[model samples]
Target: MAGEVPAAAAAASATLLALELAWSPSTLTDADIEVLVVQGLLLEKAISGWRSYFGEASPSEDWTATVVFRSFYEKGFGLPSGAFFWGLLHYYGLEATHLKPNSITQIATFIHLCKGFLGIAPHFNLWRALYHLRAYPSKGTPDVVGGAAFSLHRGGKYPEAIFKDSNKRWAEEWFVVANPTPGLLPRTGLPPVVNARWEEKPTEEEMVEVQVLLAELQKHKAEKLTGATVALSFAKWLTQPI
Candidate 1:
């Protein structure tokens, strides 16, 4: 009888601790959010330990803590990080099977982050990050969410068709479709018909659109790009003569 009472008291203590640790996004401080992430990791580790220590329980699917932490991270931070979601998936013991909704969301957020919120162009680093998210997926990769990883990453809200569009691939397809040779300069001395686009300038609306895009990207998705890539790709092209 005494032992039963002690067990009940332990249960009560656990309940109280859980309630205390519970998170409400509105009340979360940076420090508290950090704590929540750590605690979520600890729970994941606990499940791992149980599997290793006793082999008495199946792999843990106790994603309660992970789910809670993700809710906080997504709401408080407003931008999703692949690493963060991967941590949550680990906590849930779900190996990110298939083109899971979260996987699509993370990759889309990744591209959107790189585009300064324009949501175009596939940056290698962004692709690398997505690769990392899917790296050790539990059940191997199920079919991609949509045809492209990024669109599906955003809960199918985005359509990735543009990425593969022949027109959008103009920069590359230009060489194949419309090769601009020196136009056979000959004794006839006709000027070469260089089909280059020469634009005048922009208006206030264009300027505002650009500025707003930049600001929105920074606010919702962290932009971590610079011109270094352009120079690097250019340098490589120069060396390779491509």
Candidate 2:
């Protein structure tokens, strides 16, 4: 590994997991399946933490890591990646990772977090906060909390509207033009992907509160999701919804 992760960090992570595993940590929940599920989530986090601590090897390291994490959280431990996407969703909402809503799992998550948070409405003024946050803002965050980097588009000035979710593309064609209120916009035109394979198209009510937040990127005009900064943008997007 070029970056060379220190042995100390690895050892510490291993010990933490070992301690949790040894004590039958699942005792709080009597159900074996529940215990197993939580244990699996913890294990997934430990492994990812270890991998991140190491060097950047995979060209698409972050993308691959995303798949690994999602698989463990969504499939393995039965968790979804966005219990709380970005800054909009509340921390308490993380507990409801199990509540899988209709099709837009991430969107439902955003709504839940917004409603649950119940205060500290960030003044919705990200620009000012960034200025005060420090003498300078990070590259992605820039001078605003909900800037382009936090956008799903990740990069690009005019918003290519391609690199985002296909279904979202259909949503966006209409979304950008309409007035949104942290909720889903009604459907128009054909849905992105539907048929026997997808089973059905997501209904308007089904995705009513699912918000669509896309912004322009700083560095590149045409959005691209194949780089480190893109992944960092995604992290920023996930941690703090715009």
Candidate 3:
């Protein structure tokens, strides 16, 4: 009977932890939100252009572009830095995969961040931190969520289980999107687009819409993005070098 009681206690503890992850509000700061919005906008532009240029061809054929885009997504959002979402997860001592409902919601949050800028649907800021942690390359660090494993180490969302089992080669779809171009010019002057965006400021009616969205996101649970769109945006963002 005593053993049974201990087992029950352990089960209860596990359940409680799960509940905490599910119910906890992300500890995001104003700065973090600003960065996410900026990163999302940039990615939207990059990915859109990549898709348009590449057409139906696979992105694996253009590796330099892929790495550059990943760098923009990870580094641009301060994913590897101490002040971003990873810091929040560090505060809680949880890994990206261990997030509330798992990694899907985290992935959804990245998508939403971009869409949110447009004031579109599913603007929930769910998994704001976890998404960054999962997407950023860990550089073989054991303390960080990703280590030496290719699936976990590379920038961008960790490979989905379906991706692994589909026999379509997730690695090719993800890591080796295309051949690397040594002569390609790096995209550094991106219009300071995010700063210019903030300068516009929100309207009074827009503020009310934002408030309503926030209220909904507070209670919302977590929530792909197509390859054509991603490739087009990325290609255009890099090739034009503007």
| Collision count of model 1 | 5
Lowest summed-lDDT stretch of 10 residues in model 2? 169-178
Q: In candidate 3, how many clashes are counted? A: 26
Local distance difference test values of all predictions, in order: 0.29, 0.25, 0.31
Candidate 3: 10-residue stretch with minimal lDDT: 189-198
Model 1, runs deviating above 4 Å: 1-60, 63-148, 152-211, 214-242
Residue 233 accuracy (lDDT) in model 1: 34
Sort by TM-score, top down from the best: 3, 1, 2
Which pairs clash inside model 1?
A: 95-138, 104-152, 104-153, 104-154, 105-153
Model 1 per-residue lDDT at 74: 23
For every model shown, the clashing-pair count is 5, 10, 26
Residue lDDT tens for model 1, 127-229 = 3212332222222322211111222223222222222222221111100001112211111111111111111123455555445444544443334432233
User: On residues 1-242, what C-alpha lDDT tens digit does candidate 2 reach at each position?
Assistant: 64456777788788655433321111111232234335443333333332221122111222222212222232112222322232222321111111112112233322332333322222222211111111113333222111112223223222232223323111111001111133222322111211131112234553332212112122232444233332234234343222
Query: How well is each residue in 1-242 modelled by candidate 3, as lDDT tens digits?
Result: 87999999999898655533322222323343345336553333333233222122222234244211222233222122122334333433433323222232233333433343334633223222112332223322222112112122223232222212222121111111121222222222111111122113345665565555544433332223332233344344432111
The superposed Cα distance between candidate 3 and the true structure at residue 232, in angstroms, equals: 20
TM-score against truth, every candidate: 0.18, 0.18, 0.22
